[model samples]
Target: MKLHELHINDFKFFSQVEGDSPLLKIDGNHLLVYGENGSGKSTIYWALYTLLECSFKKSDDEVRKYFKKTGDESLVNIHATGTNNTYVKTILKDALGNPKTYRVSRKSSDMSIRANTDIRESNMASDFINYRVLFKLHSSKHSNKNNLWNWFLEEVFPYVKKSSDPCLIEFEALKEGPTKFLDLNGNQLFPTASLQDAPSDEEKIFYRNYRDYKQKWVTWHFWLETFLTNITTRANDLINHDFKYNFKIGLNIIKKFPTFQATDDKIKWTDPEIIISITEYEGIQNPAIKKPHTFLNEAKWSAIGLSLRFAILETRLYTADLKILVIDDMILSLDMCNRDVLLDIILNNYVNDYQIILLTHDRFFYELAKSKIAQNGIANWKYLEMFEDSSGTFPKPLIIEKTNQISKVWQLYHGKEFSMAANCLRKATEKLCNAYLSRQERINVNYSVKNLHEMLEAFRTKGMANGLNQNNLIKLIEYKNRILNPSSHYDIETPLFETELKRAIETIEALSIEANINV
Candidate 1:
């Protein structure tokens, strides 16, 4: 399903974002949201989570616990006045182009949810990903009791529970054998009667059944090991796909691909407990007597864990006609190179099919993604800025214009804000250089001053190779040296005035047009 809009009212930092139409309209099933810390980015994430709960018929208590808050009062806006109910209403479109609205609301102490018009349950929760869920999976503190692994397995391979193994049949029979002949006192009277001396015909029959039960018990023990072994194989197959993908893309950081296995050889027939052991290639090759956790660094482990989650989601949700993928600051642990690869994977592989809502606090990553998405021909993708105010938090759409930065620089310079205008001019230059480099598919430049120079050189080389006017190149280099470089460093003593700043801005603007990098 595609989310057309979401209306959040008094749920968290957002007090009321109302509209005659949808408040947060999604144009092309792709949204890139940028917000600083505590800017209610996570509020939007959880608001969507709440809406998903409503769709899935999750209980109020469960939702409250998930939010880690007590009572409906904690969920309401702290600034809310009397009788203003807090709610999150989500509007989505199904594969048939039918509109569906789901709303979750909270009052003083009451919570209620209204699902699709028919109030049908949904199983779409598996499509959502947030930091908390990922961190739990990546955390090394978890043991065999981790519920995240269990949920992952169930969601990714729901058909596993339907396996009709003969061993499972025998195990079930062994469990129900005693209960099939329980007496009024809840005792296995048949087994007890079998031990009596002068046993009657009924006692003889009980003895025979008891012997059969004992034989089945022994058989179940033997088969249980085989059942667990089969399950282990399936789990490895699923995890190995993720491991290979992660290791392949994260090769710069991780030297070798890791292997994962269940920690225990035997598993319970019901509610099996599983803990994973990640063995590094070196450890496996060298046959080390070390613990699994000692084999990799934190970053590598995080990559493996996060990639496993993505692999599970991709394997399961790739076939769904309508899917929403919510990613919240999941690339923090990844390096720049891997981040680019991850973005490429998302856009090329998933963006066309799924509605992806990505949230990030990193402005560099946000800008990089904006450029990448635009380059991928996703014209209608919306970029939003989330920030807090005295009243509450709000989301403002960031319009992408060809000359947005240069125009701002001109405005500021005309308004006599020379310092700020010079800064804007420097930023515009950096953006222009990056945009040009990106157009040429040179996306490996890191977000650093040194790399910015490399971008400038690369852009200049490409422009000149394309027969760009030498005068424009000279003007670009002059602006970079006199304005951009000095403005970026306080230690540099390059004089800046209104005339020079205006000339710098004009030079960059002209070069932007001449190089065909305006967009």
Candidate 2:
């Protein structure tokens, strides 16, 4: 289930926060979260984790260290001195086509959790997937056989197999290579083929430990038991979940250039460009591998240097279409060309998903996502900035002073024409908002305010529909790529100043006049 509106209160780093996780209502996809450092970007992720009661390997220390509240009376923390309870509310649409709003309070003590799962919205989309967020920070939830795993599991690790739906993949071994593959049922994965070589130490240890892991046991390992069953069921349920997740393309050098294999190289260049092709793809099965049949490399992790050079690699995998992916501090070792390739994947190939949340301190990428959204429209994103506050606390999220990346870009321009450029663009945005409002006034919808965010939700809806002009979309894409590849045209002192200045003035005037009529 995708979250619509979220409210975080009294959580570590976040004293209070609220925002509409605005979505492309028509498809209920492409949600843009706008925030800067410490503004509660991670908090939003945590709120879900807390509600799901998901455990993690690192969660034990993090919760005791940060999630613990400040002199929180609601929390009874005998061990940690600073423990506070945070109230997290998430608006979700459940399976069985029901709108649901879930809220729960989290404390240092696991026993103090409370959840409200019945506040389902009357209206919900038909394809909304039922997702039970069962996460444990630094917890053993996934290790148990019968417990929960991450929300996406369809077509995941081939070992995982399930036939209830097309998406669920049970993890039974296909080839009995050295290690035996066990299915969810008490059956061997493959026809028990004999292996030529003996298993390695790590493999033996894993086999021994995983073999006895009581995934569904409700005994001493009660939490693990529940966690295992929960994940198994959820993963199976999402197999046929309506909205599938996938990436449009994977990482590679071809991404840097729209054309194929323009870069000349032999070994590293052979690496195929990866696209998260959806269930809707009409192209060949393997977009990256040009040869007849391809082999998937399941070897050990390669050095970061080599991996970065390889073309088209999927960093993560999922059963459904992955609309929004959050990559934190990755791609540090990539060269300029590789970096460009990655950004290109995010922008052009990954077109189906509207919103992309890339967590990077790299100013280059931040602007890239912003530029795309700005060129597209503010409705396409919410720029969330996270940072630490006065107390040097864990971190607090800072609200993006500038909603659209255009304004942010304007503020960043320091060269001769840069300052003036932002002013001109600012004027253009003001005009568009007015035009959008005016256009939205004429359309009407039969749905109530239930899923439709507001009494005037249809206005925003219609505006969004009308604002998505073919020409505008293409132009904005060019603008976004311009920021990424600063060619001669993007020269700060370019000769387009006069035309730009005139356009800004005309747009501002036209918008002002139009807004007056709307008023």
lDDT of 2 by residue, 311-373 (tens): 111322233211234334334544454455455545553434323444555666666666765
lDDT by residue (tens digit), candidate 1, 97-212: 78866666643232445334232223342356665544554454444332333443433233122222212334445554432344334544435333334345544445555566
TM-score, cand. 2 vs. native: 0.35
Backbone N/Cα/C clashes per model: 1, 79
Cα lDDT, model 2, residue 165: 17
lDDT top scorer:
1
- lDDT for model 1, on a 0 to 1 scale? 0.55
lDDT of each: 0.55, 0.34
Deviating ranges (above 4 Å) for candidate 1: 19-21, 58-73, 94-98, 107-122, 141-272, 278-290, 315-322, 390-519
Model 2 residue 26 lDDT? 17
